[model samples]
Target chain A: MHALATLIALSLASPAAPLDWHPDLSSAEAAAEESGRAMLIVFR
Target chain B: MVRPTTLLSLVASRFECVRVTDMAGVDLDRHRFDFDLTSCILLQRADGHRYHTFGGRTWEGAESHLSVPALVRVLVRTLEEHEKAELPPRGRSGPGRTVEALPPLARRIEAGRRPACIHCHSVHDWQVEAAKEAKRWRPQDGWVFPDPREFGFSVDPIEQERVVSVEARVEGLQVGDRILAIEGTPVLTFGDIVLALDRSGDGPSVRMRLLPVSGGPSASPVERVVSTSRGWREPDPLLYSWRAMKWNLDPSPGFGGPQLTARELGGLGLAPGTFAFRVQYLVDGGARAETGRSAARAGLRVGDVVLSLDGRSDFRSVDHVHAWFRLTRRAGETVILEVLREGERRRIDLPVVGLGR
Candidate 1:
């Protein structure tokens, strides 16, 4: 319950504007592999 | 982060930046996390081998967080390492599909909200809750993001991967030496150290392989086993990762800081050398009956200044108080806490619980 509540609070706390974040994880991984780059996972 | 703004395009072009949509379900078991913080960053390869993990801040202000310059430096180094074919795959397996996917709070939530990524912190909470259910969790378990500094060595956070110093008894390692492998695992960056220690978990000694930072295969590598003292994996109390233990009052015990100054300690009848933590924030774990068992059972107040535990006050720092309590004491054990509530020093016995209990 604490986990869910904190999640809800985080969703509500997000700023009005959405940043240009990757839409999905798999696509990001695919992009990284094709580009020969690393994956940066930002948890906020 | 401001400095990273100018380099944002550079990072975007060089790496895949992802904010995983839903990390609560399957992803919970996929990636292993150490600290429970509001914000963290993990760097890994496309093959699922991790590079480095950083970014837990105290949030006092902009100064409290990591600098953009530091972040950029690390990015530049990681990119270079990748181009040179130095980064390796580590701890890689499936995408957690076969792992236990249900979070602790899953049954309490509406079905529609079950898979949602409410908060990144939920990942840590669920992992802790799950560990507790299986009776494998420990109080010192949250020190998952251990720092080399805690071990008396400082590694260049970026490409050099060189040791800055040997502060403690890191046998056979010294300044100017670079780490090659830890516990037989090939490691290239500080992120690798984080991953290694996270996987190490409550071990008695830390074994590391070292090489000359002067960069020549001509020199043979040396192996060193750094026998640790108690609380070896515990990050220093002042670190952003340590804040993962901050003050909370619900589904789990929350730890917070803004340690008491000498004046505050004096006000609480402590001496100039006293170490105490002033709780400034409250983490409401989740919903619980107001009258039932909960944080209220602990009888600790937000402003209460903790002086010692079980008559032990020889702790190293304010944060060390909590680390010592959690690391040394076992679950269901009673710790006699000497605290000052509104200038009145009283002893309170706190029943200890493991990390997420």
Candidate 2:
């Protein structure tokens, strides 16, 4: 019970990683092929 | 370097986000957009219909051109446009000219195998280097792009589809007029106009359209011509950095270092206000070792303090001196540099050569 509470507390404290960024264009396109989502590329 | 704001994070979650660090990942065939950018956010359909693009800055500040509201608007607009799913006509994305390995610097990078990757902003410098290598470097080439603001207008990135800021006392543009095209080419977004203006060569005449700001039925366009003047474009430091880097490494006269302090100046028998660069590198990088050794051969050793170039002590910094050399003098020009070498003052006439000579 205590461990469950600790996990819940930690989850609340930690920010969720927002986006799953694909390493490269090919991987992103593959994911897009599966999900029907558009590719959003941010070039730095 | 990219810290996601809360707003960006929210929008990012809804899309298939791909982060590219270098230029090679970009599609030269489909993603034809501005290559001279430091940061570009591109959203497109999976089958290569580009929805929108944002980025193009003055290149001097840490601030991005994007605001949260602006990005939100772009994202909303992108989603709306994505619903259409209509493939844009071929070659309409601009960059119609032949795209090849450009600028001598890019070739130099590929040959040296240093830095491993090319960033888009560096293309500006590479172009200038290529021009120098070809012995066609000139002052007119220094201003590589003309900002649209030179025509008494600034764009609102948020309302890219609708808004334009007309400068005070501008005669032609009206508050109700929305920019529809440039040089007779239809531009859908601000990014399109940016690419058109960037690609437009020296002193080119451009035709533009002004449509009614209000959408739909009651709209007819009025046309205007912009004769780009020779004095219109302003010289930017981003392009000038190429000369700075080349000279910092090249032999004969190219080198990089810092300005000498007043006390250091006085010790060298120079004035308190003397502008001398205390040489930090003759050729420090493996990529530049071949070219940097020329300065050493020309008696500009690593410790040498250079006082003046072309017999003038008015240079601002090492970069300034290099920019002055490139802007004022052409390739193959002779420049007399005065340096304090090994506690002895001497004059050396450096016969400037372009890259890879």
| Native contacts present in each candidate (fraction) | 0.57, 0.65
Per-prediction DockQ, in order? 0.28, 0.28
lDDT of 1 by residue, B189-228 (tens): 5556656766665765778887865547576787777655
**DockQ for candidate 2, C-alpha atoms:** 0.28
Model 2 residue B45 CA deviation in Å: 2.4
Q: After superposition, how far is residue B18 of candidate 2 from its true place, in Å?
A: 1.0
Model 2: per-residue Cα lDDT over B1-357, one tens digit each: 433344556656677887676665355546655555545667776666666665554333222244555565677667666666654333223332222355454465568754567676555456556666787765465454334665456676556645457666355555556777776544555565666675666553567787766535678887876554444454433334333233322323456688888888788787788778887886645555544665667666778788778888876566666666655565567778788887888887766655553
Where does candidate 1 stray beyond 4 Å?
A: A1-21, A33-37, B1-8, B25-38, B52-65, B84-100, B109-116, B136-143, B149-152, B156-160, B184-188, B201-207, B213-321, B330-357
Q: What is the TM-score of each candidate against the true structure?
A: 0.65, 0.62
Question: Candidate 1: which docking quality band?
Answer: acceptable
**CAPRI quality level assigned to candidate 2 from its DockQ score:** acceptable
List clashing residue pairs in candidate 2: B247-B254, B247-B255, B248-B255, B251-B294, B251-B295, B252-B294, B252-B295
